[model samples]
Target: MCCTNNCINTENPSGNCVKGYGYGKLIDGENIKYINCLEGKCFDQYILVYAENSFKAPQNSLNYSLYYFEIKCKFEREKSSVWMNIGLRNLNTNKYIYYYANNAKIYNEKDEAFNVSINWKNNDYFGCGLVYPPSNMTNKSPYVFFTQNGKEIGEEILLKDNSESYKPFVWLKSLSVEANFGNNLEAKPFKYDISDHLILK
Candidate 1:
């Protein structure tokens, strides 16, 4: 789960003030009252928040064939035109691959869009994952995948230049979102059955 200590670094592109709360919750200060401001002239800005911990594929594993990390999240905003995104960022390269919930498209760091057929609404559950295959496999390239309500969406996107580790992130405009990072599986299990893809070691 994305707790307060784990999720940090809110990057506001438009220089507007933003706040992040517990349970991976983030809220834009656009519609809220800005206290201690000079005449309250600060404009609205989009922000990107990232997790402090980065996940890496397990190495020197004899039983596990594949390594993967996933997150299940729900949009807490009301029905609107505002955009929200969830994805993973490479810790070393700082590259990103994220899913745009409103447009149902996946975008990379270069802003290239890959179309998907599904659309999501308010309070709907959606997620993204990164999978890394074993070195013995023919294709050792790592790939990213998305899900909606525990079901896979579109095809897996291969990353030829895989980074050593990645951190989960959320991009918000004017709403809030909550995420489950699979920290305590017994308390809050993941929507996707991550166990199906690999052998528990």
Candidate 2:
């Protein structure tokens, strides 16, 4: 037992630790968020958010009923091999369908990352996340797609389950991204709605 600020004593039960955001349980003071990402490369897992309401777009050209969320490239990866994924996951299964910048997947499944012709870098605002699309819009499949800037840059990906709700899921490798759920994105217009240009009112 020592009596100094630099020394650990009975009076100090909490040490120096930084609690981060994620799905992983709290340990010591660090957070283990990545469910299936490369360690030392992927990081920063936070709570997913979505807009759940029936509303109209800022303009009268679009009107829809559904829930969704989006993400933007806040930072680039340190390595060339590292990329980012913006996905939606089944709350129950925890499995997700995600997007990549320069890659694709043969099948749409959990933890699968697909490319969308997006060179996600600084100032690149990507809106590649959606929770639940109408059964018809989804083609009876649960899968979705990704978007770049203000327009979608990829094709329709498939999913196994469209029944369960989804949450925002991100996979970052040597990169960083920011998630937005229509809270304060006037500067970053949705660019394009994931619902295939919702029926105009």
Candidate 3:
């Protein structure tokens, strides 16, 4: 598990600012972040952030309320086909909202995956915030938005959920990407202030 504050990756990349998750292990030592990607080897690797309730604010933990991330992916060895995913994973209800660096998609409670319209790339700033549906008195889901160099690229998409705790997740296949989880994203905070949620730092 790498802490964003002290997860100094050896042989680090130049000017590579990576965000920290509560915990991340080199998936097969192949799939890695910018710091470890320099030395780690693997074509198909995955980094997962679990929806652990114990991971909360005031500590290096994960939260479901409000989360912001700045992620950049550099193609090290481009293959004939590149498959990658950066999204929120909720296993409890077997649902997921994913971005493929080019497009975005989501899976409903019944595990039905569908495509979403989005314009994205390797380097972009992503913000996920808690949204309580006006119609739902109790149901609330997180909405994800993408930006490039401070310019909004696409419309914010509301994720479909079914009472599942979603976690920041990554899946790489012949790709290399790194993320920043607000350990340093001070100037760029979530637009709406969140009071009840926890911060993942």
Candidate 4:
């Protein structure tokens, strides 16, 4: 049977969408670092960083991790509207620690800069070389609203803060192709809508 669902929109809006994944290798020269995907599940679904690029380094002979990214989300022409929950438990302590990105940069321009942001619903610590926001872990995740030529296009969940409940609603607003590259970026300048069905894991 030929079924046309929410996966068939040329303006690439809702239905007629494709479910695929994208990946990229982030290299800084010879000191490779691996950035894995949390929601995506593909062989190339992880970010691999190896080597070092002195040209893009902060200083000569200094170890700087500034790499461009090429991400292939599972659902193309779609935005996130779910608060998918994830966790990492400490075997020694038997404590489950939840994790989420305040914002994420999915792609970069020809200049090779990051265009992503994150909003924290909560912040907690787990002790793994990872830093947490300064607050309690709330059950709110941010979203992304895509647009072009001043026309609304599509949207997706850019970050997953929790799996319980969200308030007001969060969104990843407008991001310049030439934004700064660093951690702790916040989602800004975008609109937010509620989608009680989507979930990220």
Candidate 5:
């Protein structure tokens, strides 16, 4: 799904919004065009943007017992210390788990951090994947994983809460990022080989 146009903190009539405090403009239906903040000490604020629709996987597939939704994104410009957060947020609970690009860590809704020791640079391709086991597999649990430039990074993190209300989201600061939600593989192929993870029926 494409990003929704209803941006946050973009209604500065005086054109004096603090630098790095507002959402970037969405361009070409998938890319987030960077908006330069006013000249001053950069005010650090994360602009949260959600996709146009929630992701849903096909249910009850015997051969494909695990299902996953992945988002591939490239860091176009890295103008700030803290770059961005890419992950999934539960619509009902409002809880989120994201990969923090600055410190190479993962963070949950409680502000807890998990160190993954993977550094990224400008123009590097990175992404997050949410994998869920089949409903019939009671022993299995849902988890989150990271990928960089067509390769998996770190380990798969299992979620404590098994709710399936999660949706893809991104928190941006002063960064220009291009995201692909795997809506059409032919148009924008994912950097990671997602077909190896789960087969979508």
Candidate 6:
């Protein structure tokens, strides 16, 4: 069995929870169990793994929580100089599960310094991430959407494209975004985890 929200008798490691993430053990082109516990969220930019018994009881426990993370990106050119803030929230329980930050400073096309912060909150369980640039440069912004079972279920757009990234509202399990640019007007789609940072390329 796989470690997921839909698992039955989730009290212990009854299934392959470790494989649910990305760090699967390698053995003869097969995914072997490498970790013993698995209970958390997966953001495209990062992954938060939790303990099996950490999940709150459905009746008396918060059950849901929210987390937060912050990051900064400074490029040699003004084009890449930007800051990003991310959060993971569970509204039902009003708790935070994880929080992080990544601050980057670049010099001469080289990454000079990077700062990161990670933490867990016990308030709510709401999702958050880079919502995208604002809503001013409609033509320059990319298209963002949510997906489930390999199918798109919801969509959102960033009308502004001036900034390199934006703080998202909630944490999404499976998401995909595409950027349309150039004379060809090509569409480039990217798959991301539940993390707060995503590459526009």
**Ten-residue region with minimum lDDT total, candidate 1:** 29-38
Per-residue lDDT of model 6, residues 140-198, tens digit only: 34333332222322233222223232222221111111111111313422222333333
Q: Could you give candidate 4's per-residue lDDT for residues 81-115 as a string of tens digits?
A: 22211222223333332222323332211112234
Q: Which candidate, 2 or 6, would have the higher lDDT against the true structure?
A: 2
Which should have the higher lDDT, number 2 or number 4?
2
- Looking at model 4, residue 118 earns an lDDT score of 41
Sliding window of 10 residues with minimal summed lDDT for model 2:
23-32
True-structure RMSD for candidate 6: 20.3
CA-lDDT, candidates in order: 0.60, 0.45, 0.44, 0.23, 0.64, 0.25
lDDT of 3 at 102: 42
Ordered list by TM-score, greatest first: 5, 1, 2, 3, 6, 4
User: Rank order by lDDT, top first?
Assistant: 5, 1, 2, 3, 6, 4
Query: How does candidate 4 fare on TM-score?
Result: 0.16
Judged by TM-score relative to the true structure, which candidate is superior, 1 or 2? 1
Off by over 4 Å in 6: 1-34, 38-140, 159-201
What's the count of clashing pairs in each model shown? 0, 2, 4, 33, 0, 46
- Tens-place lDDT digits, model 3, residues 1-201: 244444434333122324422223343322344333434333233334332231112222233445544445555444334445655655455566555554455443344555656654544444433333333223544455444444434445566544335566666544555555544447645333344344322
Q: Give the TM-score of candidate 3.
A: 0.49
Worst 10 residues of 5 by lDDT: 10-19
By lDDT, who's the top model here? Answer: 5
Q: Estimate candidate 2's RMSD in Å.
A: 10.1
lDDT at 54, model 5: 69
> What's the distance in Å from true for residue 65, model 1?
6.7
Question: For model 3, what is the alpha-carbon lDDT of residue 156?
Answer: 51
TM-score of 1: 0.69
Off by over 4 Å in 3: 1-31, 34-65, 102-129, 132-161, 187-201
- Tens digit of per-residue lDDT, candidate 5, span 1-201: 113333343342123233334346666656676555444644444566777676554477454333334444444334454467788887768888788777888876676888886777667687777766666766766677778778887767776664566788777766667787777879988888876657532
